[model samples]
Target: MSLTAGGPRRDDFFKVPGKGAGAPVKPGEKAPVDRTAALSVGAFQPVVAAVPMPQRLFEHERERAAARAAGEDATRQLKNVGADVDVALTTAVLLLRGVEHPKARERVVGAVPQLAEAADYRPLDAAADFLGLDHEDAAEILEELTEHGVAGPIAEAAVRVEELRAQVQQADHEQLDELLEFLLPVSALISIAGAAAPLGALTEGDPHLAEAAKAGVVGLAAVALQELHSTEHPNVELESTELLEALTPPVR
Candidate 1:
């Protein structure tokens, strides 16, 4: 009944090896690997960084935006809160006197839009009537005010200035230089008087104006970078570097 020396019919001695759905390997042979079994399939998950973003950038932008908004709110408050007539009128008188007083310039630049709208005044026309000046002169003044972030009336004034400059055809750069020099203090004052956003309004609008504003912005940026490098203003140094990078011309 036995085949060879041992009997094969005993349930205890008979071993049935377990294998996957494929063919089973003999005792002396290596089992064939099911690659599919070894492999895993599910949703593809791309490797991503678990690293956090630098907090400096977010903080810097937030602070700058807040400062700008506060400056805007302050301007609105000036309009809403009725000011003392004597003090306000005295301030207006000082502006018309044509001296480069920083406070006077700030007040005038801010009120320009309101005054112009109320009087239905075209800036070039108003300047010519009041100061006996032409279009080139008016545009120069508009540029000055715009550089200080006195935007709305400043923009309106700029339109009239452009009209006048167009009529003249020829411009006087000498006058523009003179005006810029006189108004530089006012521009600086306005920037400092408000929040910490750099005097950005100077570079707003066209490439031409941006070019003109570049020198001042660059100079200030350089100083800021220097100061920040020495101290801790959170992201001041980083922001300075970003400013420089932004100001750099792109490669063709």
Candidate 2:
């Protein structure tokens, strides 16, 4: 029997430039247009000169606006992270996306002080930052995701992940799929089960350590969550019935 090797790529080592990466955009590439600029342009009214404008122009503008909105939303979520925890958080996400970078790995494994710090790291934003996937990439992938399967459960799972993030304890084996599904593009949730589907292998054993040779969503995120839960950011004694219900493995 033959098997495929799933792993990081050469490009995974390079940091993807976000909105203000201070680098020029390549030809044919979309410039980092801010959300406001994209939206304002969308409301543009061309002066009529006794000629009907092409519909394609409006379609192009709409697409650009959408891309900016998605990108902006992702950026907003990441901006809230404190500098202290950003690298570790992002690195864990890189594992989830299967794009491990040396820099991220170094920080994730390096210091005890670094791991002990806690914050309200929003799961969706962390997922977006980790992948560094462009808005158009998300938009394009979303179409393919929707055409092939039902995505409602996957998106709902993303919400459930937020609840998981709020927990002060490590997640158990049963919540494995929910952990990964939260990272997938909503429209594609049921399609590939997330690009980092290999994370499923880490769902057993201690449910706490759930080790993997290659740090994955469950394994890497577990490290970060265990640290965050160490201090109990929201409340040490908080209880979440809804989160528990959402993670309950469905009866087959």
Candidate 3:
């Protein structure tokens, strides 16, 4: 497939007007007229006013605001989920620590550090190394605990943590979709304005139009940057599944 070419280079419009070497004017010479200002005063303002701002731009702003609020809510929910997971894991580990079976108790107690590391978002492989317990070992340990009839609470807690983890992932995906909905239209508008800059300069001989096009590009860039700064990435990897599995007892 053919690749699309890139947009105009930065030098096309961002050049300094009088910085390069040029002949020095005599002291008596008249200053050159600022044609951009002249064009704006003469004819550009009326044409600009005739084309009112599109209603969709307003809609994009509203959607972006809503998405931002939703993302904040999601963040709050994630923190609360983490807190709940901490509590549940703590309770389960405490229960396991009291079990009389030597092998099961040793395995569960040994996994405490790994469980804590996972909860804190450490890499799964790194955390798993603490007890040398892969998922299969975890499953065997869980089965042994179930045979002793002490795994009920741990299993229930793991189920709850898993459910909460699913919710976090879903929220992240939804927030990303909302953010994309806002960005795509704004990006399209910037591309349109950028394309118009050269046409305004070369075809219409209107410095005012060119300036407006440049201003449009700059303004949209600011808007996009502000939104990005204010908003979190939609797919923030919580690494929560690792945490869930770290403490999770196998299903019957």
Candidate 4:
């Protein structure tokens, strides 16, 4: 089900009090003031307070801290992996260039250097490109060199590069997951607030009714959001899918 099915319109949320739909003014009669509309905005504030806004704010801060820590760790790991990738690519390129094997020399001559430069900032891409170049009859040539005790040290550099590339990809995915985890609760709260707005609008005039309504709406919104969070709601899935598509690398 749509999370925001009956929520206020984007413009309605920002509309001035006493300016919404009201009884029309007759030709010479002054426009009647809408006390209900005027009171709606003030009434909604209590509803917002009824929800644990302060608690949610605290939780949001904690999530942000966690996300920041995850991001820093990912950055550190990627930096080390990038250095390793550069070293591995350089070793593989140099060794393949020196090899007398016609196919290996033909493949690594000038292409590897350009690919390396093209993906200079993108370590994962660089590793994949280098591995791709090395996989085509090139590994066999490197094995032959190893059998002859030639270029034996650099022969396994491609394998090391592949392992390093996997680490980079894993680090990136972990960072994305952390970001998504932080965002999920934020989205749920926004949905809850929107759903609660209309219910709060109904209790404008009576102070006691307003208080009771605020409590009821807050409880209802909390329950609804909890259920939506636990279930595989289509709206939640759509948001997650969009975020993944936007943040994930094309190479993966």
Candidate 5:
């Protein structure tokens, strides 16, 4: 009766037979695929990581900014220490010149406590007048302090410090570490007279004079610290920070 002998129409070319979208395929034949189905206009989004692209970009920018800020801060601090160190070097040289004094006789000890012990050192007010020199007078003062035998290890240490500073100027990392290992002893190097007497200012009446003397010793020590810690002012070998850290005891 009907012209077609079927359940559903299949006149359209490539249309599925017997069933619509879910039709089964005959043996040795491929199933129909719906190429015309609605598709998303943009990129296909598979499951992605938690932190997305925009946030990752922002994080990278933020970290970069922080690093730059830190570098600028370090540079400023280095310059400031350079000035402080210049005064300290002159004070130290002046103290060296007066090494024959009765009150002076301590060198090379753990920086935090050893050098500051007044019982171990004599007064250095004789060098006080030198502290007023220009902030950049370290070279001239170094020349003065380089007197052999009298300055002892202090002079030797200072020479090595300058060499290290040159390495720092060149930003030399390759050889810096080796030099640092050698300089560890430099930091501890101090020249002391054979025997130091007890506090000589007992009858001087002026306690401040003794205090002033302590200031010079401390100043010299401070210069040493600065030489090893400066990260800017275009200063010393081994980045100083790394060297100083190496001196610290490791965490258990």
Candidate 6:
């Protein structure tokens, strides 16, 4: 951006000689100019009408008023458990629509707690943590995917995570860690599975296993490697399926 002088331009400061002014004087004397008779004109005028605010500011104030009303309505609805349910559903719909607009998203995020309270919906603290990590990780993955290409499941998973994060408001530390541990392994496994499905050679002799191993897919890859070995790599098979059988979701 170019730097502009602090005040009015040179054209604005230049004063023209007016009628009934004194005669032009020599070097030491004053010029014959009528100061009082001068009409000053600026090079540029303020295009905006001073009385009315900018269109965006006006709309912002209007939206703020609507958001305030919505908050009050939410508070009132929350007092009645039955009504709160309806309000929560309505808020969810609004939030889904508003996600396309950042300002609207901000408004909806601010109202989430009130909506939950009004609806008597138990706020899952764990869900909040999930949202925060999901947002950060998804943003990173998006940046990576921009470079890596969006042809695979990893890209799709990142998109899904981004969508989920947009809905959150109150994520704290402990809940976030739990969510990360739950999500990473599962999503990494899914991504590897997706990578392995097409053009088998491109993914290596065992595309699924290779992708899983590449993504560090916990022990799920090992189980999948064992199960599918007979079809694709009969020479390398699991000694026992007991490890796969014992795998269970961790108790929360």
C-alpha lDDT of all candidate models, in order: 0.27, 0.25, 0.30, 0.30, 0.28, 0.24
List, residue by residue over 79-157, the lDDT tens digit for candidate 5. 3323222222222333333442333322221121322243433223212112222333332232223321122345443
Badly placed stretches (over 4 Å) of model 3 are 1-176, 196-200, 228-252
lDDT of 1: 0.27
**Could you tell me the TM-score of candidate 1?**
0.18
Q: Residue 231 of candidate 4: its Cα lDDT? A: 22
Lowest-lDDT window of 10 residues in candidate 1?
43-52
Instruction: Give per-residue CA lDDT, model 1, range 1-252, as digits (tens).
Output: 100111112222111233222445568855533322232222101100111122222333244335445564333222211111112212222212222334434654554444334332242332222222344544444455545522123223222222222211221332222222212222222122121122122333332222222322322222221221121123332433443333332221
Candidate 4 residue-wise lDDT, 1-252, digit = tens? 122121212222122243222434457855533222233333434433344322333344344345456665445433433333223222222222233345433443333333224332222222112122223233333333334323222334323323322332333533323322322333333333223332223343322222222222222222222222222223443343333222222231
Best by TM-score: 5
Worst 10 residues of 4 by lDDT: 1-10
| TM match of model 4 to true structure | 0.19
Task: Name the 10 consecutive residues with the lowest summed lDDT in model 5.
Answer: 190-199
Model 2 over residues 82-200: C-alpha lDDT tens digits? 11122222222222333133333443343212212212212222222233333343233223222321111222332233333322012222222132222211111111112222112
Tens-digit lDDT track for model 3 on 17-134?
A: 3321232434885443222222322243243333222223333333444545666444544343333322322222222222334543445444434332333322222222322225
The whole-model C-alpha lDDT of candidate 2 against the native structure comes to 0.25
Which pairs clash inside model 3? none
In Å, residue 201's CA in model 6 sits off its true spot by 4.3
Query: Where does candidate 6 clash, by residue pair?
Result: 22-32
Alpha-carbon deviation at 150 in model 4, angstroms: 79
Count of backbone clashes, every candidate in sequence: 0, 0, 0, 0, 3, 1
lDDT for position 55 in model 4? 31
**Which of candidates 4 and 6 is the stronger one according to lDDT?**
4
Candidate 1: residue 73 Cα off by (Å): 64
Each candidate structure's TM-score, on Cα atoms with residue i matched to residue i, is 0.18, 0.17, 0.20, 0.19, 0.24, 0.17
Alpha-carbon error at 212 in model 4, in Å? Answer: 3.9
Worst 10 residues of 6 by lDDT: 1-10
Candidate 6 lDDT over residue span 138-180, tens digit each: 3333233223321123322322223223211112322222322
